[model samples]
Each structure stands twice: as structure tokens, then as C-alpha cells.
Target: MQTINLLLAGFQSAFELAAFITVVVGLLVGVIAGALPGISFVNAMAMALPFTYAMGATQAMLFLGGIYVGGVFGGSISAIMINVPGTPASLPSTWDGYAMTRKGQVKRALTIAVTASATGGLVSALMLTFLSAPFASFAMRFSQPEFFAATVLGLVSVIAIAKDKPIITLISLLIGMAIGTVGVDPLYGQARFSFGIPEVESGIRFVVVMIGLFAIGEVVDLVASNRDLRPKKTDGKPERVRLRDILAVKGAILRGTGIGCMIGVIPGAGATPGAVIAYGVEKQINPRGAEFGTGVEAGLAAPEAAKNATTGAAMVPLLTLGIPGSAATAIMLAAMMLQGVNPGPLLFIMDPSMVYTIFAAMIIANVLMIGAGFGVAQMFSTLMRTPPAILAAFIVVLSLIGAYGVRNNIFDVYVCLVFGVLGWAMKRVGFPSAPLVLGVILGPLAERYFLTAVANSRQDYSVFFTRPISATILFIAFVFVLWSLWPTLKSRIGRQPA
Candidate 1:
């Protein structure tokens, strides 16, 4: 009943012409920014944040949120067409997506990507609007122990997702945590790891790190591969998705949406994780799963569906409990705070109207995203046939421009160069690139939240266990960690006879 009222109220409210226009601009900008390699949603939002200072709070939020949603699917464009995922969330998409591209079905992949994103996002947003309020009321009961446990659980769950080995992911996370120490301490003003460099005192900016790791690193990978033409097995012209294709893979959509929404509802499991797990789970459950890596529709549908769904589910914590599930949501939180909107229990009571505005804008942005995604995908799809020289040159220019656009700093460009080289080196040595980027993004949040929990705990170790909700969340995190490690643990204990 409450949800219906909110929905109806949201629809009746008149969005200012300018505010609605901001959403349109944001959707367009997001699609372009996302389609570009190395310019993930974070940079897109940060890049556009300053421009919003002159706009009204609602408009600015809608614009930025639109970008945030649109950008994730954007990465799949290059991931499918060029064998390069434009964003981290698109990584799982790369396996089947790139395979489909090789078979000259890049358009098919793009269509599924865009559609799944819309479906997942809509489901998640609907969940957020209907369920966040109750969750917010529940979250207010959190104490120091519960909060601390929740933090531990979040960090552990991420590490647990490392299927081959959890230790490697944990080590990567620790390294990220260590790098996070370079900035000023939150509780104390003293510098921790400046290493005699003043710029290090503020620590490395997340935007700088992301650009270097994702964008520049990808450049190194692309150049090193140096392959000009993709192998063609299907008709040379790309396949446009028929409604039949969607119907055939209906199960993938449902499963991915369920998985994404579930993971997204949690405080730390972001869209990427949802996508990864959904991809893995989909392949495992399907009878033809073994053929997934060999290239199939289900493979493409799983991650695409989950990643889009996650964008919505991530909002559940952010709007309801004043906690953000993913880095993008965290940024959304920051953006909202900047605009003078505090998201908590009070938010629902104080401005039901604004809540409705956000709800309306999300649904509308999604509708716009479909049109925008297809338009951009087609334009890029045409360019996909361009000469390799031209393609590389375009990527290089976009990379450099995106790097410089953040702060207009030459140093960031230098950092991009250094990381580009580092990425190439790592690829040569066969280290997985995805985990490193994940560590870098999630590291600071894990550390900051943990530290906050500890400082607030004030030596009360029992606080973590005493609180039922926190304890339960922590238990789940531990379960996931143990589950991930069990096979390895058993193998270590008993070696098979050769």
C-alpha cells in the first residue's frame, strides 16, 4: 500500500523541465563515457560532478545517478565488439561477449547487454523504493559490535569470491589497505605513509588509481596483443537480437536478476560481484554449462543481467539504511550529501517528495538508457570495422583526455603511463588483472569501515558478537570465506597420488 502511494505520488509530481533535461543529458553522457575504455562510472560521475554545482539538488542527483546506471552497460559495448571490457563490471561479459564478437554477433551481445541492464536496474530500483524504508528502520538498531561485524563480513565476502584461491585476493586487499594508509588518518591528523612526498600525504586519489589501473592498464594489454583482425566464424555482419533470442534465454535473465538483487541488497557486495557470481552460477546450473566458455547465449545473458540488476539492488542499502553497497553507491551518497540531502530514516519522513522524484527519474532514466545505449552501440558498431590504426589512436586519445580531465593535472597522465607499463609487465608475468583492480577499489572502504568500527568499539571485543544482526552478517561472511577455501584446504591436507 505504501509503495503504491509512493509510486502514484511520484508520478503525479511535476519534474522541473530543467531537472528532467539534466537526466536526459546524464543518460547521454553516461552512455558515451561508459562506452569508452578505462572511463568507468566513477570517473564519469566525478568528471561531471563539478558541473552540477549550479543545478538544483534533485536535478544533479538524477543526472549523476543516470550516468552511474548507464555507464556499467556501456563497458559491454567494447567488451563485446573489441574484446575489451570498458568497465570492471563488464569483465565476466568479456568471455562470451568477445567470443560472440569473434562470431560477428557483437550487436547481439550489445542488445542483450543493454536489455539485461535495464531489466536488472528496474528490478533493483523497484526493490529499493518498496523495501528500503523497512530496512532503514531495522538498520537503526545497529550498535558498535554489529557494525564492526558487518564490516568484517563485507571484506571477507569479497575475498571469498576468489574461486581459485582466497589468499591471493586477501593479499591484494591488504596491499590496497596499505596504500590507503598513505593519506591522512581519519581519527588523527598525522600523516601515515607520506614517504617524504607531500602529494602522498593525501594518499592516491581513487579516481587516479582507477584510471591508471583500468584505462592505462588496458592500453598496455591492447598494444601488447597487437592483433588487428578478429577471427570470423558467423556471418560477417553483426547479428541483431530478435525477440526470440531473449525468449530462448529467459531463464538466464530471471536467475541473474535474482542473484544480482540478492547480492546487491547486501551492504558491500556490488554489481561486479553479482555479475561474476551470477555468471559462475548460471554456467554451473545449466545443463549445457560446460559449453559456456565455448560461447553461448546463456553465458552472455547471465553477467549482463546481474550487472544491471545490481545497480538497483545497490541502492537498497544506500537509500534505506544510509549505507552504500558498492563504490558507485558510496559516491552517490557523497553526491547526495553534497546536495544537502541526508539519506536516512529522516529522509523518508522529511522529503517523501524527493524520494518519489528519485524513483520516477530512475524508471525514466532506464527507458532513456535503452534508446541511448542502442544509438551509441550502433555508432560504435560501425566504427568497430575501422582500421586498427584508427581504433588504437581513438582509444589513446580518449584515454589521455579522460586522465587529464579529472583534475587537469599532468601528473595523472604520467601516472597513467607508469601504470600502463606496469599493466603490460603484469600481463607478461600472467597475473590476473581483475583482482588487482578490485583490491584497489574495495581496499579503502574495508579499511575505513573497519577502523571506524574498532575506534567506536573502544576495546570491546564482545561488541561484534553481542549484536544479533551484526553477528549474523559476520557469520555469513565467514561461511562464504570457509566455503571458498574448503576445496583448497582439503587438497592441501591430502595430495592425490600421481
Candidate 2:
């Protein structure tokens, strides 16, 4: 009953002119930003941060939440249309979605992507609405050790994403962790790898690294390959999707949503891993598994659902424990802090209206995304008529500006360009960059929690395993690593001469 009342109040608050307008504007910005290569929704959120200062706390949450919901779905637009993912989570879309586009079934591919995305996001938003309070209560019992264990779980989950290529993934992850260690020590406050550069002491921002790694490399590929951006026509008629088409993939959407929600609740896991893991799972179980990369409908539907599903689920830890689940949520954490609001159990008790309003806004955003997504897709499809060189040039300039905007520092831009070159090189070699980005985003948080946990236990290493919750989480992570590696080990053993 109380939950019902709160929801009613939330709707009342969210429907007000200012709040409604903010959500609509933010949703549009997010969709446009996410549909454009190199301007990820995270970048859009970061750029929108300063503007949030002019709004009230609840309005600001509504605005950012709207963007969060819309942006996750928007990336699939470019992924399906251009063979280039607008965001890291959209990587799986290119595998099958672009294949569909090549066959001139672009409209059908997009319809599957959008419908699955909206379904996943809607379910996730509802979960956020009802589950966060109880989750917050559970989180109240967490200590330093528990937090560290959760972070470790998130870190190891990346292995599931790598499957048989763990070696390269580990290398990429280690490189990111090393980069994360460059700044001042979390405990001692003494610089480790600054080398006397003042800006280095403050640490490299993940936002700059993300923009450079994802944006610049993609644009360079566009310019180098002179890729065609125009969609292919199929007998001068557009493919139409019907309700029956969506019903055919209901199971895939459900599975993807489940995976996404589970992954997203982890303190450091985010949409990239969620989407990748879902694709892997779908490939394992679907009857068309062998034809996964050949534009299977399940292939396009599952990851699209998973990526958008993570949007609302990622908000769980952020709202409950004040822990950011991904780089995007980290930006939201910064936004809240800037507004003199701290999320956690206290926020729920003290500002139920704000919490529920944000929930309502998430629901509203996902509901509205169907229209917003198609509108942006239509606009971008038309814009694809532009020359590839001109689009690439614009992407490059916008990416650089996003990098520089991190702290309004030119040094960050230099770092971004350097990483951009490295990212391009990595891509040419077929190396996975997603794991590296994940490590950069999560490594510092893991370090902070690990150090704090050890200190709290008076340097006792057993503290992580002595606690039941912490031990269980670590055990699960250990089992996950073994489970992921067993297939390769079994295959290798079977290949040995008998």
C-alpha cells in the first residue's frame, strides 16, 4: 500500500512541467548523442553535468535518469545501420545487426533491436522501482571486506566475457590497472608514477580514456577504409516488423534481461559485460547458435535487450550503496554529489519522493524511448547520406572536445590522442579493448576498497575470507573463473594423443 502511494506521488511529481520537459530534452540529447559514433552517452552525460547545476536535485536526477535509459537503447541504432557501435555495449550488435543490414533488412534489424531494448529496459526500470529499497537495507550490513569482495566479483566477471581468449583479455586488463596506478597512492597520498608532471598526480580520468579509446579509433577506421555509410535498398521497399516478430524472440529478450539485471547489480559490472555475456549465453543455448554471427534474430535481439537492461539495473548499487556500477553511473554519482545530495539508505528514508520520482522518470523514459528511438533512427538514416570523410572529421573534432572537457585541461586531450593511436593499433590486431576499459573504470575502486578492508582488519589477510558474505562472493568469483576455463582445458586434454 505504501509503495502504491509513493508511486502515485512520484507520478504526480514527475508529470510537472519542468520535470517532464527535462526528461524529454535529456532523452533526445541522449538518443542523438548515443546514435552518433564517438559521442557515447557517457560523454553526453559528462557534458550535461555542468548544466544540471541550474536545476533542483530531483529535476537533475530526472534529467540524467532519462538520458541513462534512452542512451543505452540508442547505441543500437548506429550499430545496426553503420556497422559501427556508438557505445562499447553495442559491440555485439555489429556482429549480427550489420550482417542484417548488408542483406538490406536494415529496417527489420532495427525494429528487433529497438523492441527488445525497450522491453529489457522497461523490466529493469520496474525492478529498480521496487527492489532498490530492500537492496539498500541489505547493503547496510556491508563492510569494507564485503565491498572488496563485490568488486572482485565484478572484476572476475570480465573473464566470462573473454571465454577462450582469457590471455589477451588479462593482458589488456593488466595494462589498464597499471595505468590506474599511475597517480597518487590511495592510502599514502604519495605519487607513484607521476614523474613530476602536476596533472599526472591528480590521476587520469576514465571518461577521457573511454572517449579516446572508443571514439578516435572508430573514426580513424572510417577514414582509412572509406566505408560506405548509406543503407542498401531491397527492391525499393522497406522491411516491416510485426508484433508476431517480437513474440518470436520473447525468450531471448527474457534471458538477456535476466543476465543484465544480475550483472548490473554488481558494483563494478556494467552494460558491456552484460551484453557480451548475454550474447555468449544465447549462442550456447539457441538452436541457431552455429549461425550466430550470420545475422540471427536471436543474436540481434539478445544483446540489444541486455545493454538497455543494464541501464536501470546499474542504478541499483548507485542508489542503494552509493557505489557507481559503471563509468556512466560514475558520472551520475558526480552529478548527485555536485548537487549536495548523497545516495544511500538515508536518501530513501529522507527523500522518498525524490527516489520514487527518479524511478517514475526511468519508467517514463523507457516508455517514451520507442518513439524517440525511431525518430532518431530516421534522422540518422537520412544523415548517412553525408560523405564519410565529413562525418569522420566531425566525429574526430567532437571526440577531442569531449576528452578536453573532462577537466577543461589540454593535457587530458594529449592523453586522449595518445590512447586513440593505441586504440587504433589494438583494433587492427583484433585485440579486445572492452576489458581494458572495464579495468580502467573499476581498478581504482577495487584498490580503494581492498586497502581499506585490510587496514580495518589490522592487516589481516584472512578478513576477506573470514566473513560469510565476503567469502561466498569470492568463492563464486573463483568458481566462475574455473567454469569459464574448463571447456578449453577439456578440449586440450582430449586432443592429447592416447
Candidate 3:
């Protein structure tokens, strides 16, 4: 009953004209930024930070939350239409989404993507509204050991994505971890593998690497192949999505939303892992598992659902414990701190209105994203009508700019170009780059938590296994790895014919 009253009050605040307009504007900004390859929504939020200084605390949260919800789903626009992922989480979309585009079903693909994304995000926002207090209380009991175990689970989840080529996947993951180790040590702060370069000592930013690995290589492929970018008209009419289409993938959306909400609450496990894991899981369970990369509807729906679902779930740790679960949330944290507001349990108690209003904004944002997503996707699809050379050139230029904008450093731009060439080479060999990107994102987190846990336990290695939560999660990870490999193992045994 108290929750109901608080939510009602939240609706009142969020519905105010100024607050509502801010949400709409932020959502538009997020959609555009996310739809553009290399310019992630996190960058948009960072750019929007200075603008928030002029607003009230509640308004600031509302604005940022709107962006958080919309931006997560916005990346699918490019992924579905252009074969380029605007964000790391959108990588899964390239598997089946672009395949759909190639078959001239771009409208159908975007419809499924946006619908699933909105549904998943809406449910997650509700979860955030109602479950945050209890979840925050539970999270408070987590120590470094628990965090390390959770990070390990996220790392091992990549196995699910590589059932057929586990060996190659592991190799790629290890190489990325090696790259992650190139700069200052997370624990001791001692620089390693810097080779005396001032910029190298500071470490490589994943955003720069992500832009290069995804955007530049894709542009090169477009230019080299001279692929047409225009969406084929369906009998001279726009393709209309039906209710039955959404109903067809309801199960995938539910499963993806569940996985995303669970993973998003775990600090350091962000939307990218959530989306990838959802795709892997969906591939395993769907009837058309073998057809996943061949433009299956469920394949397109699951990752889109999972990626957007993380938006609200990722805020649980941020608002309740003052821990940012993802890069975007980290910017929101900065925004809050800039406003002299410290987020935590105490903030909830003292500023229930602000907290609840932000929750309301997230709910509204997800609901509004369906329309915003369609508008931005339509605009981008129109841009696809331009000549291939012009479009590819723009992608490359924007990618370079995005890389340089990461820290306003020229070295990142150079690093991006190098990785671009490397990414193209890897693609030519059919090597998976997703696992490598995952390793780079999660490896450092695992290292930091493991080192901290060991130090806290007086260098005791058994600390992870001894803790109940950590042990349980690790056991789950073990089960996931076995499950992922079971199909391959069965196939090999069947071929042997004992």
C-alpha cells in the first residue's frame, strides 16, 4: 500500500510538463546516439552531464533514466538495418538481424527487435520499482569473494556462445585477457607491457576498442563488397508488424528478460554479457537452434529483449548501493554526485520522491521507446538509400571521431585504426571477435575482484568456495559450461560409434 502511494506520487512528478519533455528529449538523444555506430549511449550521457547541472535532482535522474532506457534499445536500429552494431550489446543482433535485412525483411526485423526490447525493458523497470529495496538488502551481504564468483560466472558464460568451437573461443578469450593486462595492474598499479608509451600506461579504453572492432571492420566490408544499403520495399508499401508477430516470440522475451534482470543486478555484469548469454541460451532451447544465424525470429528477439532489460535492472545497484553496474550508470552516478546527491539506502529514505520519480521515468521511457525506436530506425533506414561509398565513408569518419572522443586523445584514434585492421583480418578468417570483446570487458573485473577477495582473506584461495553465495554461483557456472559443451560431446561420441 505504501509502495502504491509512492508510485502514484511518482507518476504525478514524472507527468509534469517540464519533466515529461526532458524525458522525451533525452530519449530522442539516446536513440540517435545509439543508432549511430561508435557513438554509444554512454557517450551521449557523458555529453549530457553538463546539461544536468542546471536541473533539479529529480529532473536530472528522470532525464538520464530516459536515455538509459531508450539508448539500450536504439542500437538495434543499425544492427538490424546495416549489419553494424551501434553498441557491444547489439553484437548478437548482427547474427540474425542483418541476415533478415539481407532477405529484405528489415522492417519485420526492426519491429520484432523494438517490441521485444520494449516489453523486456518495461518489465525490468517494474522490477526495479518494486524489488529494489529487497535486492539492495541482499546485495549488501555480498563481499569481494561473491563479486569474484559472479564475475567468473559471467566469464564462463561465454562458453555457451561457442558450443561448436570451444577451443577457438577459449583462445580468443585468453588473447583478449592478455590485451586487458597491457596497462597498469589493477591491484598494485604497476604498469606492465606499456613499452614506455605514456598513453599505453593509462590503459586501452574498451569503447575505443569496441568502436574499431565493430564499426571500422564493418565499413571496410561494406566498401570492399559494394553491398547495397537500401531496404527493399515490400510491394511498394511499408511492411506492417502484426500482433501475432509479437506473440510468436513471447517466450523468448520472457526468458531474455529474466536472464537480463538477474545478470544486471550483479555488479560488473552489464548489458553486453546479458544479451550475448541470452542469445546463446535461446539458441540452445529454441526449436530452430541450427537456424539461429539464418534470420530466425526468436534469435532476433531474445538479445534485443535482454539488452534493453538491463537498463532498469542495472540501476538497482546504482541507486541502492551507489555502485554503477555499467558504464552508462557510472555517468548517472557522476550526475547525481554533481547534484550533491549521494545514492544509497539513506537516499531512498530521505528522498523517496526523487527515487520513485526516477523509477516512474524509467517506466515511461520504456513505454515511449516503441515510438522513438521506430522513428529513429525509419530515419536511419532512409539514410541507407545513399550511395555505398558515401555511407561507408561516413561510418569510418564517425568511428574515428568516436574513438578520439573517448578521452579526447589521438592515441585512442591510432589504437582504433590498428584494431580496425586486426578486426577485418580476424573476420576474414571467420574468427569470433565477440568472445575477445567479452574477455576485455570482464577480465579486468574478475582480476580486480579476485585479487581483492584473496587479499581480504589473507591470501586464502579457498575463500571463494567456502562462501555460500560464491560457491553456489560457481557451481552454477560449472553446470553452464557442461551444458554448453554437451551437444558437441554427444555428437563426437555418436560419430565414434563405440
Best-matching candidate per lDDT: 3
User: Model 1: runs farther than 4 Å from truth?
Assistant: 1-6, 12-22, 38-61, 83-88, 99-103, 141-182, 185-193, 206-210, 229-233, 236-252, 259-303, 313-354, 486-498
TM-scores of all candidate predictions against the true structure: 0.80, 0.83, 0.95
Per-residue C-alpha lDDT of model 1 across residues 169-285, encoded as one tens digit per residue: 667657655665667886678888878777667666545555565556655676778866443646555455799988888899889989888767666667766777677667656
* lDDT of candidates 1 onward, in order: 0.72, 0.82, 0.86
User: Which candidate, 1 or 2, has the higher TM-score?
Assistant: 2
lDDT of 1: 0.72
At residue 258, candidate 1 shows an lDDT of 90
Taking the tens digit of each residue's C-alpha lDDT, what string does model 3 give over 1-498? 998899999999999999999999999999988888878888899889999999998888888888888788888888888877888888889888988888788988988999999988998899999999787777776888888887787788778777478999999988887888789998898998999998999888777777788778777666667756665666766677799988999999999999888878776678987898789888878888768778889999999999888888889999999999888999999999999999998998999999999989999999999999999987987788888889888888988988888789999999999888888888889898878877887788888899999988999999999899999989988988888888888889899955
- Return the candidate ranking by lDDT, descending: 3, 2, 1
